[model samples]
Target: MSKVVLITGGSSGIGKSIGEFLTYKGYDVYGTSRTPERYTDSKFRLVALDVADTTSIKKAIQTVVEGSGRVDVLINNAGAGITGPIEEIPDVEIKRNFETNLFGPINVIKAVLPQMRLQNSGLIINITSIAGYMGLPYRGIYSASKGALELITEAFRMEIKDFNIRMTNLAPGDFATNIAAGRYHAPVTKGSPYETKYGSVLKNIDEDVDNGNDPALVANAVFKIINTPYPKIHYKVGAFLQKFSVVLKRILPDKTYEKMLMKHYKL
Candidate 1:
């Protein structure tokens, strides 16, 4: 039987690519998005969803469950970028980022776990980012949210491993996606502070992302992982050059890692 997959933030970018790729692989993929009309995939269904809204997330999951007998894979691909100095960003903005990038995944995982436990065979892929492993300038909140997601994935995987429920955290380094130019409205007035410190870092981030890995590449990676016998705990995909960055994260101490990041990001 073909697998049934649920993908969040599947309207565009990496999520959309994953949905399409999975469809080709014969999965009845259901994607969640606020703009469902734009996502017209005959092989995949698009349902209205706002990850920030728990009720909406629950309803979407319920709808998918109703349509399909089971959801075999849950791809937590719904996330956005909110970049600015930590101090400069407003508390409300931070909360919003966490709601979308962190709690959103948690909500989806919670909604799906019961059924998955009963099935005893399922895959949960969290679309975390390289940011989950390291902190970058001007992306404090975004990084913090993803960092939390990494830990959450770890704990959840441990809890569900006995049931053959696989939880994989796929962290892409710099995938070409709309997240670099995320549509976040600034809640604060004229620059309060942190402009000078974060300006260059943000510029570099924008530039690198603008010319980063294609979304389809990560989509292919996602497809490949689902077929793996023992899904890896962590999968890091990035441009060839970013290999050194991951290596730096592995060998260097925390403080030294920061310096290496500064050098790579040109901060």
Candidate 2:
């Protein structure tokens, strides 16, 4: 049977590329995007879904269930990026960020897990980022959400192993995608602490993303891992510099790691 895969945030960026690549590889790909206008593929089915909305999430699954007999893979890729100092960012924006990036996946996971448990098979791929593991300036809230997701994935990985349901976190450094275009770059709010200390943080993050890896590269990695016999819990896909962040985090001491981050970001 051709594998049935469901990818959230599949209209653009890494999600869309993964859907396209997997469809070409013969999997029946069903991807969900907030906007119906984001993707079009004869080989893959695109569903309208808003990860932050419970109704949208449930309805997306309903659509997928009705269209496809069964789902084999679920990719939680819908997330938002906001750049600014934590203190400067409004409380509401922080909540909104986590709502879309963290709870969004949790809801999808909750809805899909029962079916996957019953089937005793399924692959859940989270398109997390280096932010999940490292702290970056100007993206404090984004990092917090991804970090929380990493913890959640760790717990799920252990609990679901026996069920034959795999959850893998894909931490890519920077990928060339529509994400940059979608990012919310609030001004260095008038007379804020961050104005003098981190005015360039947003610009830096955006620039790096603009010059990063192609979305297709990440999609290829996702395809390979989904097919691996013994899939690992985390797959690091990014440039050499990005991959080094893992090593630095592990081998370097706390202060050293902090310094390295500052140097890398030119803080």
Candidate 3:
């Protein structure tokens, strides 16, 4: 039987691309969405899932397992984005972002682990962000949430190693997707201290996303990871510079890297 792949937030964007590509590669693919009915044209099967809700996560996993008999891969691709100066961002928004990006993925993993252990074999991929490797201006909350997930995946790997289960973090740079439309933006308040700089940085961020590489690149990476016998703990898929940024942080002094980011963001 073909490998059964389950992807959360797979109704569109990178999740959709992965689902379609894996389907073409002969895998049994199932994608999740908060409103599955909205994606009538999705290439692979889409089940209802709201990562923030524990009950919904359990039901979605059960649905896929019942339909496919097994889930060989689970891609935690569902996440939300938030942008604002850290101080200006509402506490509620910060919690909401974490709920979707960090806590949600954790709960989904918890829901899937029992089944994965029963099968004695599985792969779990968490979709993180290139920005997760560092703190980015106007996007600190997003950075922290994704970065936390990256670390969690590392810890999870060691804990599940004996079960024949594999886990990894795939951090993608800006991809041409509707993520910008979905992201929450703290309003550029009139005459506020951060209005001018925040507005400028926000515009740059959106333009980067608009001109980002095709989502297919990430899908290809995911496919590669699934087929590999011994996958690494972390894989980054993006433009050379974006991937290199992570390396640069490792080698450069803290202040120097901070300066580089400031110059890049015109902060």
Q: Top lDDT: which candidate number?
A: 3
Clashing pairs in 3: none
Q: Candidate 1 versus the native: TM-score?
A: 0.92
lDDT of 2: 0.84
lDDT of 3 by residue, 171-243 (tens): 9999999999999999999889999999999999999999999999999999999999999999999999999
Local distance difference test scores for all models: 0.83, 0.84, 0.96
TM-score of each: 0.92, 0.94, 0.99
TM-score of 2: 0.94
Worst 10 residues of 3 by lDDT: 10-19
Give RMSD (Å) of candidate 3 vs. truth: 0.6
The true-structure Cα RMSD of candidate 1 reads 2.1
lDDT of 1 at 72: 93
**What TM-score does candidate 3 get on C-alpha atoms?**
0.99
Number of backbone clashes in candidate 3: 0
Candidate 1 regions exceeding 4 Å error are: 38-43, 183-193
For 1-267, candidate 2 gives per-residue lDDT tens digits of 888899998877888888889999999889887877644543478888888788988888878878876778998888888888776678888899999889999999988887788788998988788887877777878888988888899898888889899898888889888787887676776677667657666667778889988888888998898888667878888999788888889889999999978887677
Q: Which lDDT value does model 3 have at 216?
A: 99
RMSD values for the candidates in order, in angstroms, are 2.1, 1.6, 0.6
lDDT of 1 by residue, 135-167 (tens): 767777788899899899989899999988999
Query: Regarding lDDT, does 1 or 3 come out ahead?
Result: 3
Candidate 2: regions farther than 4 A off = 37-43
